[model samples]
Target: MSTPLSATFRAILMRDIRLAWSQGGTGTMALSFFMIAVTLFAFGVGPEPQVLARIAAGVIWVVALLACLLSLDRLYQADYEDGSLDDLALSPLGLTGVAAAKILAHWLATVVPLILIAPLLGMFMNLAPEGYGILLLSLLVGTPALSLIGSIGAALTVSVRRGGVLMALLVLPLYIPTLIFGVGAVDAAMGMVGSSANLALLGAVTLVALAIGPFASAAALRLALE
Candidate 1:
């Protein structure tokens, strides 16, 4: 009897999640990078509360974006190298589904931890009290787009040697809108200018990424396999 497609998807998702949480995995590295980068920024800018408060949202958002980028290089590299990607492509879930699973797993394993920690970093940066909720909300809504949009770059460079830099070059330009609205949302909250519109726009960006990323990533994966 053939395995169910839903089961295959679940198995793939669970497998990736477990791999991500293993020692020396992307989750650990990304989280550590996020913490260290934020701490370094706080130190470099000195201890002026006003200065830290003024730059808090942008700094945290930029660091979170970089953290997401740090993990994208490995998104497809291991499977491609081990021949698991070919088997995945042949499965009932297909390449697009595979890409989707990886995207979700990446978001859950990597970005979620960053989102959880952002408030603590915000406190270190002297982020205003009002901005904390908006910070969490923005990251929750915005970071999925990072994973979704990043998967395309990951797929495009999966077969390249040391493609992490190339993937950054490809995706960094694409990340600006997300970074913009993300910071805008938090800034609006801090300024009391109403963050609802910014959050809505951020959600729109994620929606667009959701609509396009998996298909684009699957196409790239198919090309890489050929």
Candidate 2:
């Protein structure tokens, strides 16, 4: 019997999750990178608590944006090499759904951990207590946009050799809005102006990425496969 589209989506999502876990856990690696990057920033900027506190939110957002880039190379390249990409593209879920599922899985694997651990890392950077909740909230709302937009880069570079760097080049420019509103939301929450507006814009950006990313990624995948 044929499975429903919802079931297909779930299955694909679960399968990718399992695959992602099997390969030494992208979540752990991404989290490690997040931690190390933040620590390095702390070291570089010195032990001045005031300074660290001031830049904490923006630093986290920026590091996370870069950390997610580390994993985009394998987002589709593995499946493409092993012939699974062709089959998934041909499946009932279609390329768009497949891309969405993969993006969701990648978000789960990479960004969610970063979001979860942000608080602990925030402490290291002397992130203000008031900023903790907003930091988590901002990352939760904004990181999806990173994954969604990065999917397009991943798809575009799937067929290219050593595409991780190229993918970073492609996606970093696109990440500015997410980074800005993310930090702005935290800053606003810390008694800066325009808290609601910053968060609303962050949500708007994520919504736009959600609406456009899958289709654009699917198109890129198709062209890569051609």
Candidate 3:
């Protein structure tokens, strides 16, 4: 019998989280990398608070996007290496369901932490309090789309040698729209330019990704598996 949707989702999420935890440094490494990247920008641009505050939205979004990218290679590579991916393929749950759960797990593991850590990073960048809230909110809506779209790349390159570099190349172009709207929302909110339009665009992109990402990822996984 097929697994119930709720159970399958929960199981998949748990499995991914457990795996991530076992990796023993994924979160710490990604977080440290994010902090370092932000710090580099701070130093590189000089310590002008006005300039930092003005650029804070872009800095946070860019760092978070890069942080997420740092972890995407492991999204499916670990499972594929260990033979669990084969079992998942043979399981009763549809690949789309698996893909959705994996994307959710990726968001939980990567993006959620980025949101929680962002305010601290924002302080370093001299982000306004109001802009911090906008940054968090935009990331909440935007990063999942990153994970979803990234899953397709992960699946496509899972079996290839040197897949990580290829995955970055494939995924980065696709990430531009999300990055634009995400930072735009923050900028709009901070500038009193009205963030609703940017927020709406981000939501539309996310909704489209939610509907299509799973099927696309599943297809890629099937092709890789074959």
Candidate 4:
């Protein structure tokens, strides 16, 4: 009997999540980088509450963005290197389903931890009381876009050795709009402006990323395979 498509998709998703949690995995590295980078910013900018609070949203968003990048190179590389990508491409779910599964797995294993711990980081940076909820909200809404958009860059560079730098080069520019709205939402909540519009825009960006990421990544994977 053939496996169902949904079952295959779940299997792929679980497999990636398990892989990401293993020794020296992407999730561990990304989370560690996020904490260290944000902590370092607090130290470098001095302990002034006003100073840390002022830059906290931007610093957190920037570090989060970089942390997301840390795992992009490995996004498709392991499967490609091991030739399982070919089997996946031939599966009932096909490359698009594979890409989508990996994207969701990336978000769950990588960015979700970042979102959960962001409040603690927010306190560390002395983020204003009002900004904390919006900060978490922004990360929750905005980071799916990061994972989705990042999959494109990862797929594009999957066949290249040492493609982490190249993937970042390609993806970081694309990340700016999401970063802007994410920080803007938090900043607005801090009384710089109204946060509603920024949050809407951030959500919109995630929706757009959802619309395109899977197909774009799948196309890139197809080319890499060929």
Best by TM-score: 1
The candidate with the higher TM-score, 3 or 4, is 4
**Candidate 1, residue 191: lDDT:** 82
Worst 10 residues of 1 by lDDT: 4-13
Candidate-wise lDDT, in order: 0.94, 0.90, 0.87, 0.94
Pairs of residues at least 3 apart in sequence or in different chains that clash in candidate 3: none
> What is candidate 1's lDDT per residue for 1-226, written digit by digit as tens?
8998888888988999899999879999999999999989878999999999999999999999999999988999999999989999999998999999989999998899999999999999999999899999999999999999999999999989989899999999999999999999999888879999999999999999999999999999999999
Model 2, residue 202: distance off in Å is: 0.4
After superposition, candidate 4 runs with Cα above 4 Å error: none
Model 2 Cα lDDT, one tens digit per residue, 1-226: 8989999898888887787777575767788889999999999999999999999999999999888888666889989999999999988989999999999999987788788888999999999888998899899999999999999999999999988889989999999999999999999889756478999999999999999999999999999989
Off by over 4 Å in 2: 192-194
| Model 3, span 1-226: residue lDDT tens | 6667789789998888666656564566677889899999999999999999999889989989888887888888878888888888876677888888888888887678878999999999999988977898999999888888888889999999889899999999999999999999999998899899999999998988898899999999888778
Candidates' RMSD to native: 0.7, 1.1, 1.3, 0.9
Lowest summed lDDT across 10 adjacent residues in model 2 is found at 19-28
Off-target runs (Cα >4 Å) in candidate 3 are 1-3
Candidate 4 lDDT, 92-195, residue by residue in tens: 99899999999999999999999999999999999888898889999999999999999999999999888888999999999999999999998888886789
Q: What TM-score, over all chains together, does every model reach?
A: 0.98, 0.97, 0.96, 0.98
How far out, in Å, is residue 27 in model 1? 0.6
Question: Which is better, 1 or 2, measured by lDDT?
Answer: 1
